[model samples]
Target: MMITALANPKRFLDLSRTVSPWTCALAVILLGIGFYWSLFATPPDYQQGQSVKIMFVHVPAAWMGIFIYSMMAGASLVGLVFRHPLADVAAKSAAPLGAAFTALALLTGSLWGRPMWGTYWQWGDARLVSELILLFIYLGYIALWNAIDDPVRAAKAAAVLALVGAADVPVIHFSVDWWNTLHQPASILRLGGPTIDKAFLVPLLIMIVGYTFLFLWLLLLRMQTEILERRARSLMMARGA
Candidate 1:
């Protein structure tokens, strides 16, 4: 019922207008607090020395990469199954953001790895390889969407790819545990609770929250742009006819 109501473009636009500002504001405030706490307040790790600081930025980005891709896949499913008007737009708008976050994760991971593991890029690492593949999937999804000029066909094809590509998410998550990999196992989100110290954990959580809000803010804005572009296209078609 709720989904049916929101399937209308006008309702979706109004909702986007109402929600974007609050999300943007929260994102700014949380990121400010997180950065201050991470850079100034948190203690350095004894084992990792100063390199542990990279986790503040890298961890949230890595989380967002997977989170945003999952969101895209979910939206794609909704678009495919329910034929909701905004679902494909939401998925399309989210792809570049996911790709950006994924790239940031890889770049930051390499930076952290260089100091700790003696190498920036490890081809043998299962987790790293899986994450790299995730970036490629995001790129391919975006490409598939753009390659088709017909919007309906493009959405259908892209949604199928998104659904199929979602299989990689679990592999990416469990690569550390399932194989011998240099990437560390889940620390903050594990069955036995976080082994990380409180000083680092608190700020890290703040950053993660901030990153999440930032993704929402960006997604809403991108979706709004997609909506407007669609409207323009429709107007042009009407005029041409």
Candidate 2:
């Protein structure tokens, strides 16, 4: 019911205007605290020492990379099936942000890997390779969106790409378990519960929430821009007609 109502562009714009500021404020506060706690409060890992601090950024980024793509897939599915006016906009708006997060994950993972694995990258590592592929998928989706001149055709093509690319998400998640990889298995989210200490877990969770809110804030802003651009285009077309 709520989604159906917000499907109206005006309502979505109004709601986003009202809510985006709050989301931005909350994200700032949470991220500020999370960073401070992660850098100062938590003790360094006994083995990895100071280098373990990278996990604070790397882990949340990796989670968001997968999460945002999943969200895009869901929105794409809606756009393709129901033809909701804003659905394609939402998916399209999220693509660049998802790509950025995925890129960050890969970069940070590589940085962390250099010290632990003695190599910046390993082609044989399933987790690493799958994550790299996910980045490529994001790029491909973005490229597809720009390849076509017609918005409708582009949206449909991008939607199909998003749906098909979603198959990589699971592989990335379980890569550590299903194959031999240098990446560690799930420590925080697992059937057996979190294996990490409260010191690390607490800040990590906070950072994750912060990142989510940040994504929401950015996504809303991007959607607003896309909507307004479409509106402008429609107006210009009407004037020409």
Candidate 3:
């Protein structure tokens, strides 16, 4: 019922405009504080040296990559199941942001890997392979949307694929934990409050919050734009006759 109500594009756009400014403001502050503390306050890793600094950005990017895709899948599911209008918009709006985050994760991971692993790339690790696959899935979803001329068919098809790719997220997460991969094990989310020292952990957490808010900010913007574009098209078609 709630989702159906928000299916109206004008409502969604008005809500987005109402909320986006605050979200953007919060994102900037969080990212600023996060990076400042991460780079300056945290002690260098005894082993990885300043290189460990990358974790503050890398881990958060990776988390967002998985998180965004899951959101996309969930919204897509809602769209298909209840025929919720906003659900498809939310799912479609998430793709580019997910892709950007995935790309950031890959790039940062590679940067971190170069010094630590002695190579810029690795194919053997399950985590790495799965992440690469994630990037492809993001591209594929967007491509599918563009390929179809019919909006309803395109959204439904893309939703199905998004749901499928979203399933891969858990598999990727578990692959790292279950398999003997060259990638490092999870540290922050362990049974104990992060295994990391306070100085480093604080900034990493801040960055994660920053990145998450960043996505929300952008997602709202895109969703609003999509609403306006759709409305304009509707008006044009109505006038043409």
Candidate 4:
């Protein structure tokens, strides 16, 4: 009901203008605290030592990479099935952000792995390969949106691609469990609960929340821009016609 009401561009713009600033402030505050706590407050791991600190950044990024793509897939589905006006806009706005997070996850994971696994990247690793594939999927989605001139046709095609590529999200998530990999199994979210120590877990959780809010703030801003750009193009066409 609420979402339907906000589907109107004016209403969405109004709401986003009011909310984005607050979300941005919250993101900055929470991320600042999380980074500080993770860097200074937490104790070093017995084995990995300072290297374990990378988990604070790497884990949240990996989670967001999967999460944002999942969100895009859902939005794409809504746009395709129900023909929601803003759904495609929302999905399109998220692709670059998702790609960045996925790339960060891979980069940080590689940095962490070099010390632990004695290699920067392992091509044979399922988790690594699946995650890399996710980045490519994001890039492909972005490219598909740009390649087509018609907005409706582009949305439809991109939605289909998003739906098909969603298969990789699960593959990336379960890769560690399904196959032997250098990447560790789920520690923060699992059947038995987080395996990490309280000192590490607290900051990690904070960072995750911070990252989510950051994504929200950025998504809202991006969506607003997309709407305005489309409106501008429409206005120019009307005047020219």
lDDT of 1: 0.85
Candidate 2 ranges beyond 4 A from true positions: 171-194
Clash totals in order: 0, 0, 0, 0
**Lowest summed lDDT over 10 consecutive residues: which window, candidate 3?**
185-194
Each model's TM-score? 0.90, 0.90, 0.89, 0.91
Looking at model 3, residue 21 earns an lDDT score of: 98
How far residue 200's Cα lies from its native spot in candidate 2, in Å, is 0.3
The best candidate by lDDT is 4
lDDT of 3 by residue, 36-72 (tens): 8999877888877888887887788888988998899
**Segments in model 3 whose C-alpha atoms lie over 4 Å from true places:** 172-194
lDDT of each: 0.85, 0.85, 0.81, 0.87
The 10-residue segment of model 2 with minimum total lDDT is 185-194
How many clashes show up in model 2?
0
lDDT digits (tens) for residues 1-241 of candidate 1: 8788988889989988999999999999999999999988888777777778888988899889989988999999999999987889999999999999989988988887786666787655555557788899999999998999999999999999999989766766576446644544433221112387888889999999999999999999999999899999999999999
lDDT of 2 at 241: 100
Q: Which stretches of candidate 4 lie over 4 Å from their true place?
A: 171-194
How do these models rank on lDDT, best leading? 4, 2, 1, 3
Tell me the tens digit of each residue's lDDT in model 4 across 34-63.
Answer: 999999998888877888888999889988
